[model samples]
Structure formats: structure tokens, C-alpha cells
Target: MTAPRQRTLFGLLPWPERQAVAEALRTETIGGIVLVGAAAVALIWSNTPWSEAYEQIRDFHFGIPALGLDLSVGHWTADGLLAVFFLVAGIELKRELVVGELRTPATAALPVIAAFCGMAVPAALYAVTAAAGGGSLDGWAVPMATDIAFALAVLAVISTHLPAALRAFLLTLAVVDDLGAILIIAVFFTSDLNLWALGGAFAGLVVFYGLQRFRVRGWWWYVPLGITIWALMYNSGIHATVAGVAMGLILRTTPDKGEGVSPGGRVSHLVHPFSAGVAVPLFALFAAGVSISGPALAEVFTSPEPLGVVIGLVAGKILGIFLGTYLAARFTKAELNPDLAWADVLGLSVLAGIGFTVALLIGELAFPGTEAGEHVKAAVLIASLTAAVLAAVLLRRRNTIYRRLYEEETLDADADGIPDIYQRTLAVGANN
Candidate 1:
């Protein structure tokens, strides 16, 4: 973890985690850029005259079928590659709980409270809108997610001057949001419960846990066990990705002095790039190819389902997060990081509305094999773009101020009594 510069105005800020978070956010930004490009390509291909080719590629199947494992390429991307992504997410969740923001009750409350509102307000808004318009209410959870990578990427591009604490806040909130989304999938989205397969998945998870308890350090041993757990979970009528999360959560995160890294940290280091760089982009490519005709685009406004998703993501997320954060601080008597203003929080809250990946995943689950799912995907894209643009507009000037502050904080031009910023300003005035 990197220490924050001493000049930060936020007296209550946790500076120690700044470096680790910045690095993580950088990686996520890169992944997010790739994800966006992939989705763009998918959209172009799907909307072109060669749209059938896109469908053909997406629908192509290749897997062991005898054991009920045969699936389309898109399905494999959704179930398999996304399991890897969730494995990293699970590791992050454990890391935060153990050593990051969620380590303390006081430290955890702000983001937890914010994430609760972030999810709740959107769901409430979506449900009410859907019911009022007499649309199916299954897609309520679509707007309850926050795409951490996408949001971080937006911040990276548009708010370079924002305080590191703001990035940390957004990251923490997104992690909690992901946890909520995962729980929703496990609870509400599961199909038929296959007891035998579920039991087998649990048994595999137990063995994986036992390996870490006994200090087994080889990837060779853990990888096979993880695969078995994922496979069993897939057969168990629950999302297979939950197995990844289970495996990640159970891993040891505290490193020995001699070993130099915890099992979870070591694996996360090795796997995170793959998850962000390859798995997620591939999944995006497969999942984001929605062909929207002009009528369908118009339907997004009139139809309750897609309209609700857009409103829930665009308006509901920002409003909910801001209100939740304000209320939490008021109730808890905690002050906002002084370096950050309400504007910074508002920018981040809008960024949180970029609920691309998991939102689309939930859309699939919510309306599987239906045109409604396509509508949901389009709506998510539109909402995310709208949120990103709004965040950029909101944070633009703040970025310049932040940039100056960062320069002043980091600059040490001379070993004299005065700081470089003052010297530079004095020099500029003299020259003028």
C-alpha cells in the first residue's frame, strides 16, 4: 500500500492503502478500456449487414457434451470466463475485509451504507417504474450493480486530479456492490436445485479450504480442485461463479515473513491480469452484441423495463449514493474527507452508474432467451454512456485543481525554506 502525501486535507483519510488502490485502479482502467473497445466491435458487427456472422460466432458450441457441458461460445464466456473475473472479485472482497477499508467497523460503515443505498434506491425505482407501467419486474437488480473497472476507467480519463481517497471510496463502494449482486444471483437467479451436485461442489470447496489450512502452496493442486468445484456448481443449478468466490474467500490472505506473500495475494497477482485483460474483455465481446433497430431504440423510452433500467442507472444511482453518503455522514458524525467536496462524491456516484458487466449478466438471468434481455443490454449501455459523460462534465474542473494540488504535494524543487509552488509563482510574477 502506498502512503498518501502529507499535505492532503482529509485528516481522517487512510493514506496507507493509497498505493495499492491506485495500482489496482490503473489495471482496472486498462481492462475497462479493452472492454469498451470489445463491446464497440461487437455492436458494430451485430448491427452490420454481417450480423448473422456475429450470431454464428457467438452461438458456436464447443465443450464436452456427454456430461451436460456442451454450451455456446457466448455461454461459455459468460459462465467460464466470468467465473475467473469473480474469483478476482472474491479475493478483493476478502482483502478489503481483512486489511483494507472494511477492516474496521468505523472505516467500513461509510461505504457499506453508501452501497446499501446505491443498490436499494435503484431497485426501488426500477420496481416502481416497472409495476406502474405493467412490465415484468424481474429485471430490478439490473441497475443495482456498479462496474468497478468501467467507473475507475472513467475517473482515470476524466478526473485525474481527484483525490486518491475518492478513488478508494469508489472502489470500496463498488466491491460492496459486487458482493450484493453476487448474493442476488445466488439467491434469486438460480434454477432447479440439484442437491447431489451442490453437495459435490461443497465437498470440493472443503478440500480447497483444507489445502490452504495445511499450507499447500502449489497452483497445480488448487487449480484442479477449483475447476471441479466450478463444474459441480455449474451442474448444481447455481451460478458456477459462486464456486470461484467461495474458493477465493477461503484462501489465506496473511503472508508469512519467509513466504513474502499470502496465498490469496500471490494468486490474485498472477490471475488478476488474466481476469481483467482477457477473461472480462472476451466475455464483453460475446455478451454485448445487441442489435437495435430504430423501433427497438424508440421502445427503450416507451417500454417500462428498459426505461426503468436507464432511469435506475442514470438518475437513481447518483441520487441514492449521494443521499446515502450524506445521511450516513450525518448520522455517524463522520466528516467527508475535507480534500473531497460533495461534487467529488457526485462525480463518483454518477460513475457508479456505469453498471455494464454484471448488469448485463443479471439482465440475461432476468430474462433469459428473450428479446427483453436485448433491450436490457441496450439500456445498460446507454445508461453507462450517459453516466460516464455526466461524470466527466461534473469532474472536469475539479481535475485541474486536483492536478495542481498533487503537483504541490509532490514537488520538492529546492532544499530552501520556501516551497517550489511559491517560488514558481513569485518567479512568474517577477517575469510578468
Candidate 2:
């Protein structure tokens, strides 16, 4: 008997996982649309007669004096609300690392390599551009992120007939990309070293993990602890979002005996809607209000830092991801899924260039409160929009081709009463 076939990279997901991913994608698609709308409103309002009001609202500060939390509206969204978003991200990442695509070396290699190269190339390109133009290289990491929500939204808009594996690949790539972005923020963006607060935050995380290890259950137990950890983390001089991710990672992803879902999965399900629909969109509403005038638009191209951001997102991401995938398949045991073509990979690479959310966060950190910050934000917006339009054009054509193929496949399956694809899959399983 022939041995069971080894799964190729980006191969089909199992049914249950596939269903979960599909549901998550649908939710994210809606969130992406809402985020885009919020961004548009921010841009229009920022440029209108009430521009000052927009700025005033974003810059206004109020806080809990007891908690040492005095922050502007924009900071609250970025540091506070965005923590909820990161917590959800952390849960997703933990799931992938534990039981999803990243659980094994063979399945994880391609996307992980692609994600690293994707980040490195953009940072390198940004460094080259910024240094050549005598600009600071502080914003080198801004374009390293792929906003999954925006990318998914673009795919939904295009009505792509791309394989499910392709979407799974994007999701895995984005998860790794997020982890990289988080590390960069923690290492590069932090200023004051409040060791006391940091230690306190770490202790809270330990207790959080202990609770998970003991299988201690209850929202009451977690909610207050989560808040205290977040507050301490904020005071610790590291980004508060790091606390959110820490708590998420500490949560158990595998369900206890007789449980329907893992704690991490349950929390992710409950929190994901709020994270995507409210936290993320609200963050975008505050972050994407950069000036887009004739001169400001010109500055995105002329200014060294902002220009680097544009190049990094539009050009660097494409080259990084495509080349990384190709080289891995060429040299390693990893193989691209047979259902996808190089052209499909190219389109997905372009789609990865829609670096909106974390890109804006990095830009804010890199240029904090400077005129350069605004220009860099504008560059991000411009580059992301350009990437989205280009990806739409390419994917739409590919989608048409795939639609035809799918129609033919469906017709053949109807005649045979069983699809050839499924027949082959069953045969392989039977052989095993």
C-alpha cells in the first residue's frame, strides 16, 4: 500500500477548524468595513472647517487620578481600547501556536519565514530610503504590519474565489506579523524604565497564569485582575497593550474535560466583536485624521521618513512576501498548495501591503507628537489605499478565473455525484 500523502504547505484545513476560521473571517470582514467608514469620517472631519474641534477632542485629556491615568482621547483609544484589540489578537495567536497552523514545524515554516522576511524587507527598505534622504530611521518598523481586518475587507469587497488555504495562509502570516510588531513596540518604543511598575505587572501576569493553570474559572476573578494588570502595565512604561497580550497568552487554549470551548477561545469569541467593531474602528477614527492637502500630499512623497513608509508598504511588502514564499518552496521541503498558483500568491502579497492599524500605531510611536508623525500617518494611509486598489484589480481578475474553474468542477461533481477533490482526499485517508 502506498503511504499517506504528506500535507503540502497551505493545504486544506480540517472541517471544524475551517468552519471556525470562516466564521471569524466573516466577523472581521464586517469590522473592516466599519473601520474604513470610521477612517473616512476622520479624514473628512480633519480637513473640514471643524478641523480644530477634531484635534481638540482627540487631544483632550481626562483620567483617573488614583490610577495615574491622565491621557488624551487619542491615547486612550491607542493605549486602552486598542489593548482589547490586542488581547483578541493574542488569543488568536495563542490558538494558532497551540492547535492551529503554527502547531507543527512543517506546517508553520512557510508562513513564518514569509512573515519574518515580510517584516525585515520593509524595515530594511525604510532604513535605506530614510538614510539616503538624511531622515531619521526611527519609523523603520511602521510598515511591518499587515492589518488583517483591512486585508480581509478588501478580499470580501473583491468577492474572490480564492482557495480557503490562501485565506488561511493570510491569517497565519498576519498572526506572526503581529507578534513581530508587538516585540518591536516593546523593545524599541519604550522610554522610561519603571521597574517597580513593571515588576508589579509581571506579578499580576504570574497570578493570571496560575489561575489558568489551576483551571480557576469565573469572569469575576479575571476581570478585576485583568484591569489591575493593564493599569500596572500602563504605568510600567511599556505599552499597555503588552499586558493584554500577556493575559491572553496566559489563558488556556485547550478546553478542560467536558467543556465545549477553551477559555482562550471563549474569551476571544466574546471579546472579538468589541475589539473589531468598536476598539479598532474608534482607534482608526482618531489615528487616521492626517492632513491630505496638495502640499501635504506632496510631502508624503518628498519627506524622507514618510516616503520610506510608502515605499516600505507598497514595494517592500510585495517583494518580501512573494520572494520569501518562492524561495522557501524552492529550497525547502515545503510546497505550495496545488490549488493555488504563483499569481494568486502575488495578489495575496499585494493584499498584505494594507498596513493600517499597527502601522499607524508604530508611526505615532516613532514620530510622537511631531509634524513628521502626521506626514508619516498620511503616508501610511496613502500607501494602504494604493495597495488596496492594486490588490483589488489583481485579485478580481484571478477571482474570475477561479470562478470559471469552480463552475467546471461543480458540473463534473454533479455528473459523478462526488467531487474528484473529495474522492482523492478520502482515498488518501483510507490508504493511511
Candidate 3:
């Protein structure tokens, strides 16, 4: 028997208006571009002569003297505000699991396997590098991330040279890669915690979900409580970012047109903008500001943490994703998307290696100490830049070559109404 939907989007406005607004919200693609730009700026800052001021600027304080939060520059911005990034991530994840590509195991299998390999092999490669070279293997997990913004940005530039099958594989591969990265962070990267605060955070989550049950449409009611939940979780053993994800999930629902707007669309409308625009760009400005003071370019390679991360992201990611997907597709007997060739897969695999946001994120958490974090930043830049270049070359084939490369097929739009522009772009004026 179906349990009745506990609530709907009924509010001061008509339900249709609310849903229409939500659909409009879902369609905005500007956030993705902003995020890509942010990652690029951060990498550029870390690698440039301005690294000293960039890193030091974050140490400055904000707020009134009496109770000002003195989170270091990056922590204040990346850790604190980036929690909102996690919140949006949580919403996307919930939606995907409920009604998107992840809704089917058969469809999900190749990407899922590819994601697993992409994450696993990089860590293993880093571990080998770390242990053999007198590095800290505890930092092994740092290189397993694939930054979607950077990856997408690269895809944006090179989409015209690849086939549709290749583009689809890359998107699915990246999505699953992100899922794996989130799991590693939640499970592997946290520090010690306090139970009382944890309990409070749990209570806040319950309250948030309870609002969903009651069909609460007022976003204000949920936002403050979400912040409170973050504070409690921060004070508790759980990472503060986890709190964002928790709160975001509570308020999100799936859309089904009914007597009024769908409950799910209301939350999607409200959250996607904040997450994509404000949260991600701000995160870029903050996280990317590492100054180039302490170490020279040559020094980065000598540092174990950064070197490991660079190797992992560049060499390990490309090798692992290509080999893993190839093996899994062979073994699982999963049907390959017919439009792509093996060469196209290889080219797109290079794009998969552009692990900017998440790699640096892991780098920060893994090497919390000052100089160590710098090494992580340096290595990430090296690897990301290398991967970005290689992807471009691999994808930079002639249109005529790819035209001869594959045939036609249709693709679906993301929940956000943007069809896979990457796939569409790949066809590049060919007959659809």
C-alpha cells in the first residue's frame, strides 16, 4: 500500500506559479560555468607569483570583536561557506537517486564501475608513491576526486570533436566519480567529534524532515535551521559540510504535477540557484587563493603530498578510468553507447582526469597543516593542468575525422532542462 504524500507545495501563491518558478530555477546553466571559472582562478592563483598574498589574505578576520569567528581565510570561505556547496550536492544526489540516471542499475552499471576504478586506482597509485618515496600514505585518498566544474569546462571547449557515445560516457563517468568522492570524504576525512552536538544536529535533521512532512513551503523556515544544524554538526563529531547535505536532502522532494505544483520542484527551484551561483563561485574565490610564498616551482615536486596528488590526478586518473571502464564494459557485457569508438573513449578519459575542486578539497583536508596544504595545492595544479591539456589534444581531432567516427542517436536533458550540451556539441553541425 502507498503511504500518502505527507505534504504538498500549497502556499500563499497558486501551486502552478511555484512549480513554474522552480522549473525556471532548474533550467539555469550559469552556475556550472561560474564553478568552472572559479576552479580555474584558484589554480591560476596557486601557481602564480601572487601565492603569498593569496594564502595570507585568508588569515584576516571578519565580524565584530566580541564574537567574531576567526576561521582562517580558506576555512572561513571554503570550509564554512562551502558547506552550502555540499548542501546543493545533497539535493542533486537525492534527486538523481529518486528519478534520474541512477534510477536504474542496468543503466548505472558502467559509470558506477568506472567511478569506482577512477577513485580506487588513483589512491592506490598515490599510496605506492607515498610509501616508496617517504611520503604519508594517510594522504592517499587526496587524489581520487574529479572536479566537475573543471571537467565540464574542458568538455565545453572540446565537445565538438568527440562522438555522442563518448560524451554520454564521460558525463555518467564524472557523475559517478563525484558520488565516490563524496563517500570518501564522509567516511575517511573527518576528525574527532562531540556527541552532544551530534545529537543536536540529528534533532535538527529530524525537524527539517518533519517540515517536509507538513509541506512547508516557506524557505526561510528551513535555512536558519539548516545553519543551526551545521553549527551543531561542526561542534559535533560529524563534519560541518555533512550538515549541509543533510539539511538539503530533508527539504527536497520529487515533482509530480497534481492539484498543485509538485513538492519536489519547489525545493529544486529554491536550492539550485544558491548552490550553483553563490556557493560555488564564492568557494572558488576562497579556496583558489593560496599564495605562492614558501615554495618555488621546483620545490613542489620534492614535497611528498603535492607530488603524490599531481601524479594521482594526472597519470593515475587517466590510466585507471580508461582501463577500468574498458574491462568492466567487456566483463559486464554492458552495451556501449553505439555512437562512440574506443579512440573517443580514450580521449574523453583524459578529460575525466581533471580533478580540480574535489582533489584540492581532499588535499586541504588531508594536509591540514600549512606547508603541507600548499604542497597539495601545487600538485593539484600540476596534475589538473596536465590533464586539461591532454584532454584537449585527445578531443581536438578534426570534425571530419569524428564525422567518419560515428553515427546518430538521441540524448536526454538533465533535470535542469539543459540537454547534454556536451553531446549535442559533439555532433557539431552534423545531421541530428
Candidate 4:
């Protein structure tokens, strides 16, 4: 070998990396719990002797058709419940844009760009491969979502091997992926006009925001209001679930109020756990129930259900997100997140391809990827599973390579009579 590579310095960092690693691992475990629990419940509901009961869910009626309809379930559970998931997602998205990562365009640039790349490439690939068409056009959005729960789980699994910067990059990128999914849903999959219902829903959301300012009490304080918004949106022809997002925004706690001290903080504390623990888990259980007893497996390939979802989520999500982020960064001069290398970015981009929960939701309404669209969902599930396992493996390998490289580089610098950290510091002062 010509000469051994030198350590880049972070490896020799003075502070312990264990704490940060532990935190990342903890976050990952939560993520894994959510995914495994949701996936497990879904399989049970979809495959058992109760399969018929599960499939009939979509057709089950919930609201009074004549007495002014309300949210009901059979099949509505998957779509309606998932709306809660979207609502949380939307709430997170809006919050990020306001005060979080997406707050400043500059700070937001890297992930925004990366998210776009990740989305566009996957969609284009899905369309070409699946020749996904006709009514299928409506479901183009299926693959655009990142399923942060699943993606986060993958992140947790791969955390040990990844650098801190790469972890930051994945989090940011996943949000961007969620943004694409939301926009796609709002724009592409909506129904015919329900102007009256929509108008009322809009007004209710405005009132909810005002209530937040007044420091509303108890989680139930906004419940009636949120329910009304949901009802209005449902009748208004807008997807009723959009109301969940509206509720999140309205109910977001103010930071100024704190420590059982502020009403806002208390409310957030209550809602955060409730939403994460209860609402999200409920949504996952309902949404994951897809029916498998349909035409033979071979017939599924030709069916729109499997083809659309499989291609859209697996092929479309990755390609779109990766390409969008890549292009945005390139032309705009936005930096990749500090710790992430192109290699790291690319691997996580593969994980972005996982769209299990949200993909299932879209399949029900626009495509019906399970009973209605198994061929498509099967494809999506297979692809997503494949991507998750492979990406995890690759990230582990990359981490090993990085550790070995760091040691070699450090040793070489010492042999050359230069202390890596001390010499670099002196050189900077000399240059100054």
C-alpha cells in the first residue's frame, strides 16, 4: 500500500461518545417497539380466522347516513385512524417549519434538499417500473412518505455504526420525506368539493388556535372542538383526518410556560405521551391490517394494488427522496449535514424507502393495496423489508471501516512526528 490513511480526528475526540450513543440507541429502541408492535398486530388481524372480519372493516358503516354523518368504521378504522398518524406528522411538520429544524431556510436547506432528492427519484422509478397508471395516478403519493417510526427504528439499529452527523442528517431527511407525503396527500388524493363542511372545519381550526393562546385545560379541553373539526372536514369532502393535524397545531404547548408551571407545558407533556403512546399505537394497529386472501399470488403482480404500492413505496420513495435532496444540495450549495458523508447519506436514503404504515393508509383509500391491492402492498412490504435489512447491514460495515481508518490515520500522523490534535491546533494558530 502506498501510505496508510490518517484518522480524521473525531475518533480521538476528548469526550466520551458513549452517552451520545446511548441516547441514540434509546431513541432507536422506542422506534423499534412501535414498529414491531404495529406490524405484529397487523399480521394477526389480517391472517387469522378473523380475516373476513378485517376485510369487511372498510365497508363497515360508522356515521349516520341521514342524521348528519359522523366518523364511523369497518374499513374506516384504517383510513380514519391513520389520519391521526398524518395529523401528528403534519403537526410535527408545521412545528418544524415554525420553530424547529425547518425554521430557517439556511439551516433547513440540507435536509430539505435531501428530502426532495429522496422523494423524486423513488417516484420516477416507481412509475417507470410499475407503469402505475389510470386510477393508480391518484396513489402516486403512496411511496412519498418515510414512516418515521420505521425509519427511526432502522436508524436506531444502525446508530452504533453511524456518525453523529449522519444521525442528524437522517432525522432531518425523514422530516423532509414526511413533508412530501403530506403535500402529495393534500394535493393529489383529495375528494370533490365539500365547501360547506370545509368552511366550517377551517373556522373551527382557527378557534382551536385561539384556545391554545388562552391556555386550555386538560387534554379534553380541545377534544370537543377537534371532534367538530373532524366532522366538518369529513362532510366537507376534505379527508376528515386532516383535522388531526389541525388539532395538533391548535393544541401545541407554548415554551414560555413550563415545569407544571405553565399550562402550555403541562398540556404538551400530557399530549406528547398520550399521542405517542396511545394515539399512534392505535393508528398503527388499525392501519396495518391488510387482507391477503385474494386472487393467487401470481395474479397480484398484474393487479394495481401490489404494483402501485410496491413500486411507489420501495422504488419511488428512495429515488424521489435521494434525487430531490441531492439536486437541491448540489445547485444550492447547501452542505450535507456535518457528519454525513455521501456514503452515509446514500445508505440512509435506502432506509427512507420504508413506507409501511402510511403506504397502507393510501392503499385503502386511493388504491386498497391489501384486500383491494395486495399485489401492490405485498410488493411494498417485500421491498421495504428488503431495504431495511440491507441498509442496516451496510451501515454496520461502514462504521467498522471508519473505525479502522481512524486508527490508521492517527498512527501514521504519529509516525510522521506530528501529533494529530496538537499539531493541527498549532498549525491553525500559525496560519492565523
lDDT of each: 0.86, 0.90, 0.69, 0.62
Number of the top TM-score candidate: 2
TM-scores of the models, in the order given: 0.88, 0.91, 0.79, 0.77
RMSD (CA, Å), each prediction: 10.3, 11.0, 10.1, 11.9
> Which sections of candidate 4 miss by over 4 Å?
1-28, 56-60, 63-67, 70-76, 130-135, 214-220, 251-254, 257-268, 276-278, 291-296, 299-305, 368-372, 402-432
Candidate 1 Cα lDDT to native: 0.86
**What TM-score does model 3 achieve against the real structure?**
0.79
RMSD of 2: 11.0
Kindly list the per-residue Cα lDDT of model 4 for residues 326-420, writing each as its tens digit. Answer: 67778886766544555666677777777776666665566644344545555556667877887787677767666655565577676666646
lDDT of 2 by residue, 289-368 (tens): 98999999999999899999999999999999999999999999987776667787889899999999999999999999
- Residue 343, model 1: lDDT of 69
lDDT per residue (tens digit) for residues 40-91 in model 3: 6876776678867766775666642332234666676666777877766666
TM for candidate 2 is: 0.91
Better of 1 and 3 by TM-score: 1
- How many clashes show up in model 2? 0
Residue-pair clashes per prediction, in order, are 1, 0, 9, 40
lDDT of 3: 0.69
Task: Pick out the ten consecutive residues of candidate 1 with the lowest summed lDDT.
Answer: 423-432
